[model samples]
Target: MSISMKLSRTLGTAFTGLLLAAAISTTAQASGDSVKLEKQDWSFNGIFGTYDRGALKRGYQIYSEVCVSCHSLNYVAYRNLMDIGFEEDNVKEIAAEFEVEDGPNDEGEMYLRPARPSDRFVAPYANEKASRAANNGAFPPDLSLMVKARKGGPDYLYGLLTRYQEEAPDGMELADGMSYNEVFPGHQIAMAQPLDDDAVEYEDGTPATLVQHAKDVTTFLAWAASPEMEQRKRLGIKVMLFLFVWTGMLIALKKKIWAKLH
Candidate 1:
């Protein structure tokens, strides 16, 4: 082939490849988040983002009442609750509600005792077998890193909690235990709709609607996944400011030092 003809063919192929990649990306994004997933207004999103304390507390309440039955929050300790605005005494009281497996009194046998603030969040099932049995052979995942694990983060979780439907969409067929959820990766999820209106009594005047509960729980889970987000952001700001001031000082020193040479 002539040089120009060869170049034209290469260009055409490159353009075609780019178009194909863009199409695939669009399809993947549409499948993941298009109609079903709604973006949430989170307190902790941008550079100055901070957790919404009220929403965090309410989210914790939902997790305690509903999610704890199936999911485990093993990475979280009772003391961590204080980060979300719980008083120290209240955190202690909440921790004490659960019995934690502890010591082998000299005999090397494990025993159960009241949980403390230092104790890790208790798992509902004794073992994986027990947990799977309770959920009809489907293992309930740990909630500790759920928000981070998901692609869409908190919004995807919120959508899953609120978007379950009894009937599958027109072309979809669901397995016996699976239900339809718009935002779930494959459209069929084992988990049923977890929250309903008035499922839990809200201490704050916020109405206990399904959407509200989902939003609160999403906030709580987001905080769980990144409790140090605020600290990290703050540290980052301090470092940037230090660098800026240091750079100015160095520039001035460079000018003063060079004045002698000039």
Candidate 2:
């Protein structure tokens, strides 16, 4: 091809790519957030607070396959997962997926025990291996409550994960040994997109796209932040009811007490 023709072709390809990406982002944005959680701050109140279980389960699968390798959720317990709607039998079965060293038979000797519902989810690497791997020796953040901690919480969490380009943007500085993240705590984060299109199979009907994974995982993190989401709504209703009744009674009492004076 002539030099001028080649240049034109390359520029056309670049423009086409940009337009396609914008179209996709626009469509995903239009799905209309199902949960009422704010998109700009990391609080967890929302319409359902509970979303697609399939999404949560897919997120758990992704975490196990990708994220758990370098993070920890020491605050979580297997039993606490009853809140996730896991039955007792399944919880124990899931917990037993790991082995723990427990004091043997009250004799003060240690033995390997199957993890229980009360046991914390295990970190993938013992310690040093995890540190050497990512985030410049900083442990990859335990994502259990990540959505809650991040501003824009769920929406930002989802957007950041799925929004990677095949290469870093021009003029961006990524250290020789580090990676690029456009929207991380420092913006010069050590982690890259741990997830992207077709990285894993989606058991849920959610399309096997990067954004879907982000949405699913964000939903899972939201659940971890407040497993009592349903309860919070129920209690909110009860409290509002009690306040209404009490206020009415007080108004009636004031009227009765002041009848003669009035």
Candidate 3:
């Protein structure tokens, strides 16, 4: 074959491969989105929205009491709890509940000490290997950015939490030790149903239903993922107002100049 013909054939083959890959990717994404997620009315949904402090606090309680056993919040500090409405003394107490590995002392030994407000949230396991070993070779992902990490955000999380099935559908054979979840991509998940009716008693008199637990925890995770969302929205509103005012002034100034010229 001539050089140009050979080159043309190679280009055609590459183009075909690219088209095939694109089709496969699109099909996979469509399949993934086929599972319709149920949306909840969140407190922080709109431009003027802000995090609900009550929900955040409840979510933290649920996370601390249950989810903390498997998942870690690596990015959040105990001090961050104060942002969600906990008092400094309460935060200090919460931090003291967990032990963290401190730096090497003059004796050149790493020592265990109570976690402080400045310290990051402690992981349940020291490392990935240990975490997987404890959970039957499945690694529990960190919850710090989970709200943002998943495609449907809080909606996906809420569904995953509340959509657990006691048994898999009649035809499907589930893998050993895996629980059926309607929202999970494969319909099988390693983590069993975490919430039950009245799983965490609410100190604030909120009903401790399973759905409430899911909602509160989702709200908390959303806040953890974007603690600055409220501030950002506030700043954005101010900037938009300034731009509107500036544009109005410019329009008035233009009219005045044109009138004087005329």
Lowest lDDT 10-residue stretch of candidate 3: 27-36
Return the top candidate by lDDT: 3
Give lDDT tens digits, candidate 3, residues 150-207. 9899999999999999999999998989999999998989999999989999989999
Which stretches of model 3 miss by more than 4 angstroms? 1-33, 254-262
Cα-based lDDT at residue 132, candidate 3: 98
How many residue pairs of model 2 clash at the backbone?
Answer: 4
Off by over 4 Å in 2: 1-48, 104-109, 128-130, 133-136
Candidate 2: 10-residue stretch with minimal lDDT: 34-43
How much does candidate 1 score in TM-score?
A: 0.84
Error of 1 at 192 (Å): 0.7
**Clashes by residue pair, model 1:** none
**Which wins on TM-score, candidate 1 or candidate 3?**
3
Candidates, ranked, lDDT: 3, 1, 2
Clashing pairs in 2: 36-47, 40-152, 41-152, 79-117
Clash number for model 1?
0
Better of 2 and 3 by TM-score: 3
Error of 3 at 249 (Å): 2.3
